[model samples]
Target: MRNLFFILFILIFVSCKEDVLPKPKAYLSLKYPAKSYKKLHFERPYVFDVEKNATVKDSKNNWLTIKYPNLKATIDITYRPIKNNLKELLIESEKLVFKHTVKAEQIVSNDFINESEKVFGSIYEITGNAASQIQFHATDSTEHFIKGALYFYTQPNYDSILPAVDFVKKDIVRIMETLRWKD
Candidate 1:
């Protein structure tokens, strides 16, 4: 009886698991393609550079959807001719960005200015589980205004998709850098 009691005590102590808390969520690690860019060929109100691997869906209203098939992601571009609504357009763009504030851990903005090229804009990087990880708006402040948002086809898992967001964020910068408003 004593031997059996000792074995039971040992089993109880030895098999005790440190509280089996659920495992922390894990993110994916991925490989990306080499980077190269080409000028967008479609005739439009503006011209910019895009990743050679991406396919663009053009709309009659001058909006564009830059699709990355492998990543199952897209960068949607919206175009507006700046007649007299620059302020309104700017506000609207910011409003669209802030729509994610409820879910975003934080939103960061980086201003892009190329006075020589007449391209001025801000790129917003939203952290956490926001629907859009990156967004931007660029303009000549007179003739053209363009806003872009990044989205993934799958659910928004910010950490898992961060590398993809970063990959496209650089492309958006390239777009802002190479932007030229058509006359």
Candidate 2:
């Protein structure tokens, strides 16, 4: 009689408990450093401002690499002298950017022209699983031509790397905006 009474009491209390509720969505809390830039003092055909946190590597043929060690990403830059091949350079740049169409959802092209600086270019912002999230080309239309692309070390995961993309994007834009062709 005592054992039966104890089992009945336990069952009643267990069945009276509240149901578990689902939790709300949560995201990572990432803190980035403040933005600062310094003029690239390297002896090159062109000059631009780079982020203070980045490391610049000089490569053959006036090519440059701006590495963000903290973000594990690099902005590759290729500089070419425009003789009569401006057409070819522009075509090649567009072709390289469009190659990502197989994976990109959409590509946003923004045209920029600075008359005083004689800098004209187009910036392509790609959204999706594309290998390169950003690609751009700038030129003086007479002497200097520059192309750049942004790449992460890790595999493409747009959602996860979106924040880092935005962070480095500012630096890239800074490069474009401050770019000046050297005579």
Report the lDDT tens digits of candidate 2 across residue range 98-170.
9999999999999989999999999999999999999999999999999999999999999999999999989
Reference-based lDDT, each prediction: 0.93, 0.95
List model 1 lDDT by residue over 33-52, tens digit each.
88899999899989999999
Clash count, candidate 1: 0
Worst 10 residues of 1 by lDDT: 25-34
- Top lDDT prediction, candidate number: 2
Q: After superposing candidate 1 on the true structure, give the runs of residues whose Cα lies further than 4 Å from its correct spot.
A: 1-29
Q: Give per-model TM-scores.
A: 0.84, 0.93
Model 2: residue 177 alpha-carbon error in angstroms = 0.8
Clashes (backbone N, CA, C under 3 Å), per candidate, total 0, 0
